[model samples]
Target: MAKARSASQAASRSKQARKPNSLKSAKTEHARPDESEGTVPLELQQKCLTIFRDALRPSADDVAVLQEVKGHLYNRDFAAAFAKEEYLRVYASRWSPSRALGYVRVLADIQDHLLPDDELARLGQSDQESLEIVCLGGGAGAEVIALGGWWSVVTRSMPKIALQARFVDIAAWNDTVETLHKQCVTAPEISKYASAAAREANRPMLSGDAFSCHFHQQDVLDWPENVVHTVITPTTKLVTLFFTLNELYSASIPKTQHLLSQLTAALPANGFLLVVDSPGSYSTVSINGAERKYPMQWLLDHTLLSDSQQKAGIETAARWEKVVSDESRWFRLPLGLEYPIELENMRYQMHLYRRLATKGDG
Candidate 1:
């Protein structure tokens, strides 16, 4: 009888724990439909639309506040240089200044593969003989030094070696210079190498003369035409592209091909092009295709490089390999207030191309 009573109590508890069907039916009746069936209040819908419109609009007050803050942090003379559209594009994006800094850190890690100390020593000796080295899309110049430490080392070896270092970018040229200065002052290791470079260049350590780094503020498409004719020589050793290509819109692929052709045309036999970009694993949008994929081999076929350039390029090319082939690295952000849709499957590739030896070459 006691066991029977206990079993009865257990059953009673189970019944109490279960929701009644009548209650479930009531909930179902009140719940909103998955599809809007013109049942939603028009006034409520209009209110939501108004809120969204306001959210989308950039307020002048907010702009003023942001500008004041940036001016304080950077400098008092800082003006809103970028267009409102461009500013919104960058500001609304998930890639904030902090994210950009994180990306820079990742770039630094990858650059480690490029200029191992021994390689720097060898490259230094080569530079002493007047090897022209140019960095394309050199953002902030951090990756340039981090990967091409050989440049600094070579400068130290041959102070009189005429080295032409050109930094190319579309915008933020002054900001890049400021960033380089900040890094030189704040980052001790980078500062040491930079100081050494200045000494080798026969410039004063802390003077503006050390700021001889050339800045080219031009579209990448125009780069080869504008600078290539003037700067490129047969002895040009290295050309680098770091973390800049991914920012390009996918529609610019043809433009990219044109740029590659221009680079190939400019580079002498035995010159090299080193490209580093987000891995293909990152998601990208394509206008016609489902998702964009980085065609690395296509880029390789487009460029000119020698055997040695190809070898050096490959050694520095591993960091971006995973990004080009992996799908996991790519993701889509929300379009305004909409939910994030899966980005069309897109991939990235990093490449190093060497110019082949010319006819009658040794």
Candidate 2:
């Protein structure tokens, strides 16, 4: 009887040793996709593999192509260079295409409210006057494009108005700048904001004869005197401060106030300042009945615009007149689950202000 018991114990030990390591195992032994079997579906596994392949393969190609295309190349060489840069940039940057696409889909959902048919017709008018527009602290160019869409509604129907635009940022991702340039030159819908024909006709004015748009690499606090001289000239009619003041405000409120003072001094009396910023609050929005809290109000309160500036700035007649009493226009963008991780916690508002006339008005 003792010999039989010893043999049985030895067999149990051998069976335990044959089992796989819990920590090293690729899949959990007890977990199941269907909840009945202890295994994942074959289709799910294939889907994961496909995603991994797509991400890894494109990333490898982007690195290779970007390296190969470095330095100046002709227009024909640009396509290949751009393709590689875009692939790497989109993947490498904080905002991914999949995420941006999701936001775009949301915008498309509210297209009628954001951009109505009458607005589109007004944009297509032929007699509209052009404006010299400068975008301050513009990042990634998405805000520029969105605003451009609104400008397009005003320009598409109005061909006489030539929109001469300049974008200034502290630092720009090469891929982002390149993408914006391509969209400006090729994409008709995007070009409609500035009237592509006008841009083609006045190509020299568009990018300072560089065969590129005016994209400057400069810091906002200590902006180059020469660049400021060029932009604040008598011709500049509109200045856009999009999502830039928030960074400054959060870092140092005093510095932001000082910068705003300088900007106010630079603008002509009749010139327009369009400020777009994130709101400040934990407002909840539902998507498919799922509640998500987005810090909408907190973003706005932390922004650079002071109460004084809000009250003193010139106002306009915009749709958001009730909520945005101090400014002419106010707009908000909803937060979605599919929003890029970078923009997930924020909502945006557009503030349009006119420079108040001084005692010795020019």
User: In terms of lDDT, which candidate is strongest?
Assistant: 2
Give the Cα lDDT of each candidate. 0.38, 0.39
Clashes of 2: 24
Model 2: ten consecutive residues of lowest lDDT: 1-10
Q: For model 2, how does the per-residue alpha-carbon lDDT over 26-110 read when each residue is reduced to its tens digit?
A: 3223322222111222322222222222332333334444344332122223224334435335332322222222222223333
RMSD of each: 22.4, 20.2
For candidate 1, write residues 101-126 as lDDT tens digits: 22223333333344456654565565
Where is model 2 more than 4 Å wrong at Cα?
Answer: 1-88, 91-129, 187-212, 224-226, 281-346
